[model samples]
Target chain A: MERGTQPVIKARVHVGLKAGVLDPQGKAVEHSLHALGFAGVHGVRTAKSFDLVLDETDPGKARTTVEAMCQQLLANTVIETYRIDIEG
Target chain B: MERGTQPVIKARVHVGLKAGVLDPQGKAVEHSLHALGFAGVHGVRTAKSFDLVLDETDPGKARTTVEAMCQQLLANTVIETYRIDIEG
Candidate 1:
């Protein structure tokens, strides 16, 4: 909390299949929901999120680092999209 | 969309591991990030989300159904907590 000391920042990344992509897993879950008596449920899709702690002071820099991390490892941009949220 | 007909509702369920739960996978991710030179990253945690389309008109009813779905299928509540969001 002191000036010039590294600040801990929190961030969350959400990754989901891109629009127009086939989601067979989603379809299967929908069927299961219907069978379980959630009869009117449909159009099920899934996503994964990561919560991170960063030893950075600047929110901008933290977002930049996390964005790079997503690009390099977390997301498959070819068929998926991701959204990042930063919390101070 | 017609009166007396089922209305499609959008809902999202977010399931996350409870705090204090050991997250070895998160640790592994932190290590990987550090190895890749994001040295300041730590305390990484993960979660999953499901996007659902429900054929229910009432927002309250849709949320109730989604909550039940989370209990019955989407989440393992022993060590996890879930949040549900509905979009009209």
Candidate 2:
């Protein structure tokens, strides 16, 4: 399948803070959860997801493009890691 | 399995904007993609994920607990819906 004529591809990107990176937001949530009586829960990590739809049928190409997107803009690669899942 | 003695369960919560909700962030990302020559991409939506480790063994119980977490804190039910995946 060509680029424009390709099937619709969905890319789900999961961006998360790297281990040892300080996450104030996650810490705040953990505190709130504890206050709410969820003490048994710990190591709470907050992450973001991006759902992108592209007119591309090739999974490899889609992954490549979205991975670039993640590195360039979708995520801050300095202190974050991203996992991309592409499906048609 | 009992509450405190149960194995640790992982709950992945995906929170996404509800249909018909205005997504300015997604729009901004779409615009950026177009500027980057990804014109074939459209209908971008931004979302959040919460990875929680709970000291629970039963799948059903874990789901119930995480669903409550979503309703009470993790998600804004008015303009967002959350899906919880529990794993041991």
Candidate 3:
């Protein structure tokens, strides 16, 4: 970590439930919205996005690193799918 | 809801902790990742995204509806900020 070096790489990981997986939280949201009179709303699902700032400089490496992170920690692959977007 | 009518509108609402807000969950996640050998990672923040499927056809109205959802239940406005993305 040197002074005046390349800016930190940013990785956005979007983690979401897989199709057909039951999501009680999402169901609650749909119900709440309907009770609030937003009857047009349906199929509400909850997901998570993580912003990771990493010291990696190469975009390819950064994406690979973050994808590993998602697989290891950020996402539950059995019931979730994740997409990684990287920018320097 | 007519058969084979206009496609459902999709809205993505990203809810995040405001700057200067204390995020224990984010800190814990960062620590966990570092413990697992991702030492290069830093400034890790966690955010929630909501995917809403609506019967509404107009993108503008769809955005408005989801924004209202964020203000009312999707986010804690005092400590959170949200961005809405709408698509059909």
- The prediction achieving the highest DockQ against the true structure is 1
Looking at model 2 chain A, report the run of 10 residues with the lowest lDDT sum.
Answer: A1-10
lDDT of 3 at B76: 94
Candidate 2 docking quality: incorrect, acceptable, medium or high: medium
Model 2 agreement with the true structure over B1-88: per-residue lDDT tens digits: 2346566888899899999999999999999988987787887999988888888767898899888788889999999999998876
Indicate the worst ten consecutive residues by lDDT in candidate 2 chain B.
B1-10
Tell me the TM-score of model 3: 0.90
TM-score of 1: 0.91
Clashes of each: 0, 0, 0
Off by over 4 Å in 2: A1-6, B1-7
DockQ of each: 0.88, 0.75, 0.87
Clashing pairs in 1: none
Between prediction 1 and prediction 3, the one with superior DockQ is: 1
Best by lDDT: 1
Q: Candidate 1 regions off by >4 Å?
A: A1-6, B1-6
True contacts kept of 3: 0.92
